[model samples]
Target: MHMLSRPSVLRFDWRPTIRTLPEGQFVAAIGDVHGHDHLLAAMHDAIRRELDELGPRSAAVIHLGDLIDRGPRNREALVRARAGIDGASAITLRGNHEDRLLAYLGGSPAALGPWLDAGGEGMFTQMGLDPWRISPGEFRARFGEDLARWLEATPVMHRIGQLVFVHAGIDPALPLDRQDPHTLMWTRRAWIDSPGPYPEGVAVIHGHIPRRTVDFRDRHRIDLDSGVVNWGILSGLVFHGDRMRLLQVS
Candidate 1:
């Protein structure tokens, strides 16, 4: 596997909001995986190599969610994400796609239609079931129950010091504590278009909208969804004290 690395330099304008992690703490935040288990594996290997060179440190590997659907190995990706990298704590967030699955599993039969439309039918196909043919009760007995438990366990947001990690961007108008869970997992243009100072010294790390590359141009937000399902690239942002780096595996 080939890997790409680059120094992540925050611009002066972003200085007011972005803060450093605690001394000797390191965090590797991965973007939306979308069932690319091979890319996820390669990324873990790359992060392990990076950490080896960094010496002893407290570390965490945060997956920015969308761990299932749209690809062939949804269950494999979810399992690997839960296991995380060997030397770091694993933290997983909930994306809108996972929310859809959870809704259907929670008894909203209508949710399955939209979920299937959003590439979830592929997940059922990979599981050797036809999404169109399976009834909700049958699906739950086969796979939904376990998957719902996993998705339910995932938090919508995670915070370590001033770094806030969410599947999608948060509501800029509200304080972190006041944010709606829905906005944390689903907001798009409203969150993206807002020119936010982001509640003072708080920087948001998120993945929802897919892009050709990680979006690091923003002052206080980092968009790491590199369209892995389609583009064949997966990205992660590494945070060490105040310094950051971009890592990508393709």
Candidate 2:
């Protein structure tokens, strides 16, 4: 099993200091991490190191969801998330895999097969459970309260000052808040075609699809998922000032 970052206690005063972030430029957003525990830990550490070097700048980490799936370290990811980096908010979005996990808990036949096919098998293994044939009784006995925690904690989207962070892209035609659930994680060209720069001037940072799989033309959408499940390096974005540094997960 892979190891993930352990939870840390980082203090921050979100009340007024958050208003001090620079008024401009860019911030980072990370792609999907389907249970690749070690890679996510390395990426998180690297981003912190970058922040230390930059100093007193406003920035945030947009996590595009799927923290649990194939790699076997969801618990670790949660711990790290609870640890905050000063002046930086770790915004984690909900992914389709997460939806399936919730549905599986509710005994949804539709979610079971696909969840298993999409590397959810590893997630089950990490939990010390079997995904192949998860009886309803098995879920209740094993995951127990942990399942509820995962669903309750997952976030749908974040609007950090001017940046909009989500697991996927916006509906383009509609306002960010009113976006359809399916479109958030499943949108493609249509969402990209709609005219607008997020909410007026806000830049939207999102992740779900792998960077390698999408056409470079659509790179404007900021895809961070580098497919770590298939030996693909985890990818992330670091924002400092008006420029964003693209990084591959170590």
Please report the candidate that would top TM-score against the real structure. 1
1-250 per-residue lDDT for model 1 (tens digits): 4444442322112122246888789898999888878778888887887789785479999999898889878878888888888788999899998888888777677888899888788678778998767777778778756655876789999999989999999888888899899999999999878867797558899999889966666768888898987787788888887778788877
Q: What is the C-alpha lDDT profile of model 2 across 117-209, one tens digit per residue?
A: 776777666678766666745775576666456565767777766666677678766776787877776676776566455554555666775
Candidate 1 local Cα displacement, residue 204, angstroms: 0.5
Please give the distance, in angstroms, between residue 211's alpha carbon in candidate 1 and its true position after superposition. Answer: 1.9
lDDT of 2 at 199: 51
Clash count for each candidate, listed in order shown: 0, 3
lDDT of each: 0.82, 0.64
| Poorest stretch of ten by lDDT in candidate 1 | 7-16
